[model samples]
Target: MAGKQALNIVKIKKMKQDANPITVITAYDYPSAKLAEEAGIDMILVGDSLGNVVLGYDSTVPVTLDDMVYHSRAVARGAEHTFIVTDLPFMTYHGSLDETFRNVRRLMQEGHAHAVKMEGGAEIAPTVHSIVQAGVPVLGHIGLTPQSVNQIGGYRIQGKDEKDARRLIEDAKALERAGVFAIVLELVTEEVSAAISAEISIPTIGIGAGRGCDGQVLVFHDVLKYTSDYREKRFVKTYANIGEQIRNGISEYVNEVKTRAFPAEVHVFAAEEGVIDQLYGKGKAESES
Candidate 1:
């Protein structure tokens, strides 16, 4: 496949204007990022959802800026040609502006990310504006922010009611005005998501927010079935059951080993005729002498 064209805010905005649906995937490691790039993904997000899918955490709350930097570095190395965005993680951007700038700098300079994605609405708009002013691109996320799961009362659909829908629209507008290149609408009702997309000039990337979005993103593990125990999300449409395939392959290998079927003649290396015997005999002779 051809190499991915490097993306920037101009190109991303053009994609939205042209009605070309952008493709995004969350990749936590080198291999997944490389594969996603090869598969022609438009963007790679090093989401804090790695806390759940890769690190075995129940939620994204515990993910730290260091964790994000480590994973984002891996993804950046793997997909140099693709646009990469790294999450700021829980509380990383909620504190002082200095702290937020430090986190964004780490993600960009150390982690090698092209931009940073922050989860919140108008409340975080000023922070986003400040970061953007400092020459750091920001991707805003609203609707069911995972970092606020406890406060939001679990992973439920957001903006289902009229009041919430209006709020979501305003959030999108606020984010756009704050200089966010794009926004991610997660778990909002389809109608509300569509309204937000229409209300904002920047692209809206949806995860569980239906097809009304200008772009769609899903976790790498979710799309490829990386773990058998991963409770399938309604929004995720698994493209491959690699977990099952891996399990079956491993089982076959185990069975072959137990039955002495593996390491067959073709798999084994043979020395010259009588070479082993000569070595042993020579060693014995030397010892005896």
Candidate 2:
């Protein structure tokens, strides 16, 4: 769990047995994922959330399979211990049911994601079923799915009404039947989320679905305070203001350079006596040292 072997079934099984609710964060690159790994986060999702968080896009619709693959590979390099899951971007899966198999294989084989996640339930069950049948682990996503944000009319809470709530439950069951290792319930009612968690045999990891879920996941940027300008959501519990720290550090560095006060002794390199003599007279050593 502490080494190069990425998150494995043993860890996931123990995670399920512990009942402590695993915490997952979206990490788009090596540095961010390395930070998440060092911070002891339970999982790393190379999410298409990167469209907004990393690529500065308005929505996940613009995120492509190649974009996800490139970032997932970078994240996989750093989050060697944390479970790394990548999203199947728009059109790749929803375009055609048969195409889902081809795209999912490319994700696992090329992107290096342990599993793939897709939004929707009963409507996407056959696709999910086929992927699992082909031996790829699938994680189901329900509730306020981002890929269908246009159809859903912006990010909003789901499963509040009886019809929507029942549909959410049936969607969970459908995904469970299709053999997903876990399900992500985002922006759904907490009570409904609890019911689904209770009913489902596999793990239910939630975001904006409240504490009743078997686990919770958040985008790394949101959790780390990287997107300070973005609206804070009810589900995001920021653990640190790393963005501020990063900004301050950069600012201090700029100030140091501006004042010519940087290159502190410990930060500067040393040269051999003859090398220094060859490069300059004796005064260079005195001033540099």
Candidate 3:
């Protein structure tokens, strides 16, 4: 197979202009990143969703910057050409501007991320601009920002009413003006998300925000049945039931071991009869001495 072409801000912008739908998937480790790249995915987001998916956390708020950096580096090693965008975890960017810059820099320099994504709208535009000014690409995330789940009162669809829809559109515009290369709209009303995508010059990557987006993103675990514990979401279309297959395979292995069917001749290393006899003879001589 031909190697994937390197993706950058220029290429992504061109894709939006050409009306091509971009593909993005979350990957937290080397194997996941390699698989995503092999599948011709356009972008790999090292999302703080890892907190819930990988680390057994209930929400993204508990994820630290260090956790993001560690996973981002692992993903970077596996993805050669696919664009890597890592999330600036909660509180990392919500603090002072200097703190935001520091955290973003760590993601870029230490984590080897190509871009950084942060949640918010007009309120965080200034920080987005500052990060862009420092020569780091920013991907703005609006609508149902997970970091503010407490403030938003849970993972509900945003911009439902006319007033809030207008606000979402304004936020997308503001983020574009602030110099974000792209924006991610999560759990937003379809009409409002389409309007925001239309108003913004940059690409709009939707999670649960419907089909009117310039692109779409889904968690890797959601796409493949990596875990059976998660509650099904409206947006997730599971392509494979890998979790079931894994469980079945493990059960087979357990049965084989219990029956002593495993490590049957083919699984064992054999020794030459002559070599075995020579070793036994040597032991006999040593005992006699």
Candidate 4:
């Protein structure tokens, strides 16, 4: 088991400054987090995308603060060195500053996350500042924030036109000003993403936003092909079809059971013939009595 020393934010900052692209992946449970740590991944996000990938919800809005805390704690326990960033689920930070502080504190103290990520731009900058002042690191998220999917109309690419692109650039700058360690650019145009990466002093972590970012992030389930029901997205590249392998392995077990070939002599326990005969005699005596 790995020890519980979290990755330093300074290292990630230096990586961005040195132009060394960072790598981040989402892990929802202990097994996934442990595997990511063993693989030496740079960061692990206990994203609310867990709702879609793990909890069977159609959208992230259905996720709650309690849900994030539960999964974040599991990931934190498994990941020792890798930096852990957990999402503040929808509506957790959008209300009063006291409410935001309470929830963010719970995520850090209870969930054991190194950092917390929240959506929105300038509108939430004050909340971001408050959290940072309270000694919690904040990772700002803009450009196709999933929590805003209903308001934005759907899961479409952001920063397409000049007006939207300009606003995105401003949002990134605002978040950087608000003291966010990094920003997640999701479903933005490549040109816009590259521009923001160039403009921002902090790192830009991209998801479905092309390769020009300071780092790239993807869900573990998508990378490992963990399920056959998962929808393939343009940005997702399936590395290993573990789902198919699992299916085949289970089928083999089923066939072996049907054929009575699984539990061979080597799989059974043995006793002396005299002991077996004594057991049989005891049973006969009891029945006769």
Candidate 5:
């Protein structure tokens, strides 16, 4: 399989015009990052989704900048070849441009992310611009943003009606104007998703948005069946049912352990008499203990 392409805002900018689809996936830990990189994932988002998936939180709103830093650093270590984008958790980008820049720097300088992603439109244009000016690339997220879950209500499709669609299109434009590398469209109608993709100068990476998007992103847990929350969304096409497979495999192991079928010689190591004697007079006391 093709490995991850060299990832940066410049390549993504080119992809916007070239219409090449980018692939993004969230990875919170080392093993996931290593496998995602090896599987040729184009980008690894150290998204605040980890607050829910890894930490068992109900929403990402509670994830702090420190939390993002810790997870981003871990993902960065395991994904040397993949471009890693760390999310600016909920309140990290608020109040002042200076504050935003400081948080972005911390995530980049300490967390080692190539870029940062934030959710907003015109309201956040200034912050996005300031971050880019400060030398950190920004990725925009629009339409059904999770960070605004409380304000916007629950998770649902966005940009369906005419007003909402227009707003989404405008949001994409605004993000492009703010000099974002790409914009993520979440839970949007296919028509609106397509329209935004066509209107934007930056690549549109979709989640619940449809096939016309320039790229697609999914939480790692949702993709790999580690998500134990709700069932799959309409847009999610499961590539594997690893959950059931893992469950069955573990169940078999449990049954085997109960029946004493696990330690069937191949699973344990044995030593010859003379070699054992050399190591211990009869056997090591540590072993006996």
Candidate 6:
């Protein structure tokens, strides 16, 4: 009810061409997706960050294709009008082309996602190409891919130097050629992100990559401060303190219950006058009254 219309590949590409900044948020469940839709977010990503935020995992490397599909289905049901992109979790796309296609098919058919996002650079372009050719839209990701965090030696900013910057640029261009409608640049240096945005025709959705991108994305929980123990990140701008509010509200409920202040007269149902007397002994009820 909040958004204008669902965005498609053509419209998304047009936004980049028109220099319109697209907005995206990660929503892993029904209520989160509903909130994102009601807020009129342009796109909803069923990100594998759910491993950390939703599933209590240490990193996204532990997330699987099934986890993505389950969450994507919930998000799709809630945000029916918004474009939904589901992540191909670790190892789902690293196999043979046929295996990758099967994974992509499950995300599209069972997950009900409009598109599937894969991490890596030019190295994975051919796989992206094959998915696109199979009639599935692909979103590319680069710069600190979480699925390969261990390989990359942890979540470090990428493209700080000349050679790394060039590689990112090449990755972006190759993704474009491979037919990805957009690419996500995560934790890349601002200069390199801007350069990639300028160099490529497709929109670049930035997380920590800076303002030069055609669009931006952040996790729903991160934006709303929904995770009580989540450490503050440099790139995140929390707009609300819902976690504290929840804690306070629940604490109040507990105090009220302990004090017998809740379930007062207004919260109870009255029995007929004689019914109570009959339930207890009549003489006892009369004497008590």
Per-residue lDDT of 1-289 in model 3, one digit per residue for the tens?
Answer: 1566869999999899999999999999999999889889999999999999999998999999999999999999999778999999998987888888889889999999999998999999998999999999999999998899999899889989999998899899999999999999999989998888888788999999999999999999999988968579998898998888888999999999999999699989877656744877646745776
User: lDDT per residue, candidate 4, 154-239, as tens digits?
Assistant: 99999999999999999999889888999999999999999999998899999999989999999999999998686889998979
The better-scoring model by TM-score among 1 and 2 is 1
Candidate 6, 1-289: lDDT as tens digits: 6536899999999999998999999999999999889888999999999999999999998998899999999999999999999999999988898899889889999999999999998899888998899899999999999999889899999999999999999989999999999999999999999999999888999999998999999999999999769689999999999999999999999999999999789999988878876887678776887
Give the poorly placed runs of model 2, Cα more than 4 Å off: 1-18, 228-230, 264-289
Query: What lDDT tens digits, residue by residue, belong to model 1 across residues 121-220?
Result: 9999999999999999899999999999999889899998999998899889999999999999999999999888887789999999998999999999
Candidate 6 stretches greater than 4 Å from native: 271-289
Q: lDDT winner among the candidates?
A: 6
Clashing pairs in 6: none
- Computed on alpha carbons, the lDDT of every model, listed in order, comes to 0.92, 0.85, 0.92, 0.91, 0.87, 0.93
Off by over 4 Å in 1: 272-278, 282-289
Q: Is 4 or 5 the stronger prediction by lDDT?
A: 4
Instruction: Report how far residue 16 has shifted in candidate 2, in Å.
Output: 3.7
Cα error of candidate 6 at position 139, Å: 0.6
State residue 133's C-alpha deviation in candidate 1, in Å: 0.6
Of candidates 5 and 4, the better by TM-score: 4
TM-score for each candidate, following the candidate numbering: 0.94, 0.88, 0.95, 0.93, 0.90, 0.95
lDDT of 4: 0.91
Could you give candidate 2's per-residue lDDT for residues 32-60 as a string of tens digits?
Answer: 98888888887788888899987889999
